[model samples]
Target: MDEIYECPQCNQKITVPSEIDRAAQLELAELVHMGRRIDAIAVIIAKYKLGLLDSKIMMAHITAQKDTCVRCGNKLLEDGVTNCASCSALNLNWQ
Candidate 1:
């Protein structure tokens, strides 16, 4: 459900959409509480900001032309790198 509220200072009505992945926040919180080291936080943030990262990799996978990172599941976006910037996967293709 979406959240509707009014601003305090400006008194303007604001509408905030709920998260697309409902349990993602809770799961992330749980990981933090469990003292788990998350190496893909930047990747998650990138997915939120730049969505093409996923689509591009998925497209490559579907087409079976490009190599995708084993760890991050994302193809090479940056040049001269054998590993994924997201999860730091060395092998790009399936093993």
Candidate 2:
């Protein structure tokens, strides 16, 4: 019998023989959770070296917004005000 699985990298469905061990799959999951791009690539390389061609791709997504008072490093609200709510500084920039 073969077990069907979804590829997290390319969203492709594949089936592998049930005889394969589960420990290798768990190890791959751990590597994906590391959250470093280079580390993820290294894991892929190592898997390939061990004759494991069917590997997963990991991606780290981070979003950062810049909206704070220049004088004070405090975050600014929706309105573009020079003074921050916490600190009264006349240097707020929002974008």
> Highest lDDT among the candidates is held by which one?
2
Clashing pairs in 2: none
Report how far residue 20 has shifted in candidate 2, in Å: 4.4
Q: What is the lDDT of residue 88 in candidate 1?
A: 51
Window of ten residues with lowest summed lDDT in model 2: 56-65
lDDT tens string, model 2, 1-95? 75444433335444343443455444433444444545544554565332234332121211012355433456766442234465554321322
Question: How many clashing pairs per prediction, in order?
Answer: 0, 0
Give the alpha carbon lDDT tens digit for every residue of 1-90 in model 1: 744443232333333224524454434334333444242244334444424443233222221223455344666564322445565543
For model 2, the superposed segments whose C-alpha errors exceed 4 Å read 6-11, 15-20, 36-54, 57-95
What does the lDDT come to for candidate 2? 0.38
In angstroms, the error of model 2 at 32 is 0.5
In model 2, the Cα lDDT at residue 2 comes to 50
Question: Weakest 10 consecutive residues, lDDT, candidate 1?
Answer: 56-65
